[model samples]
Target: MSLKELLKKKETAIVAQWFDRVVNTYQLDTSRFLKSQKDAFANPVGNTLLQGLKAVFDETTDRMDNETVISFLDPIIRIRALQDFSASKAVGFVFFLKEIIREQTAKETQGNAALQAEMLLFESKIDELALTAFDIYMQCREKVYEIKANEVRNRTFTAFHRAGLVADWEEEPRH
Candidate 1:
């Protein structure tokens, strides 16, 4: 069977393994909560992550469009970006899929050279997906920084205004 067919057959197991790998990135208690909580409201991060992984896997196995993949990646990466993770850790979840796919398909592709080649191509697509995820991560970080900077600016302006050291432009005489 082709690599795509093999991947399709093993999709559930691969995605579950991929989700576990991602949850493992968190602290022990948080990881356990994320893994055990199935409710979307109570475990939004876990829900978004599992859904994103499944969608990304489907895209990788099929069309692999950059935009569609980014849409799936945004929520997961955004949550990580807002957390204390470094850029690598934030985007590293994408790489988990690669190892999961290899482990899931190893026995089937072991002696099949063509399936192995197809696996290589599929893994290359995953690399591209990771690149896209990194871009999304950076964008989310930039937005977070922008928000922080704006908050500081606003607070500074408020303080200055309260001290009568700064005035609104509208308070100035007409030029």
Candidate 2:
């Protein structure tokens, strides 16, 4: 694969793809959504949606266009889409946030430093955030999968406190 392809294989691209999913939640396809850009800023509700669209669009990549903002003094909100991520960190963490993206977008986004520095900083932060989120997922899964400790000890040579059945002394009482 080319460098672009490789970068796309990284999490930054995957993260951008997630934006694509979020954008469509409004029933607007990418091309159609962007096509409505100008009119989007023309009305009150249309303008609010437009602002959200621009923020998410800018978040998906490191670039922005003046046309993105309909007019003066638009708010610069941090979308937190990409965290400060290293290439290696991305390789390690991308899948943790998989629930955030749709499958098809999983292709195409590999990104590069070509994006603005601020964008790069946001993407890079994925390293830490991914790890933290994954850890939470693992802990929840562990508790969910935890087996009730077999209380075989109650009927064994040594008496143990537990409900139903006796367990070997070697078995721990806690999950």
Report the error of model 2 at residue 148, Å: 4.0
Candidate 1: worst 10 consecutive residues by lDDT? 166-175
Q: After superposing candidate 2 on the true structure, give the runs of residues whose Cα lies further than 4 Å from its correct spot.
A: 1-115, 150-175
TM-score of each: 0.88, 0.26
RMSD of 1: 2.5
lDDT of 2: 0.38
- In model 2, what lDDT does residue 35 have? 35
Q: Write the per-residue lDDT of candidate 1 for residues 82-170, one digit (tens) a residue.
A: 89899899998888888888888889988999998998898889888888888898899899899999999999988998999986788
Per model, how many backbone clashes are there?
0, 19
Please list the C-alpha lDDT of all candidates, in the order they appear: 0.90, 0.38
Model 2, residue 15: displacement in angstroms?
9.7
Give Cα distance to truth, residue 59, candidate 2, Å: 12
Candidate 2 lDDT by residue in tens digits, 69-96: 2221122111111223332332233333
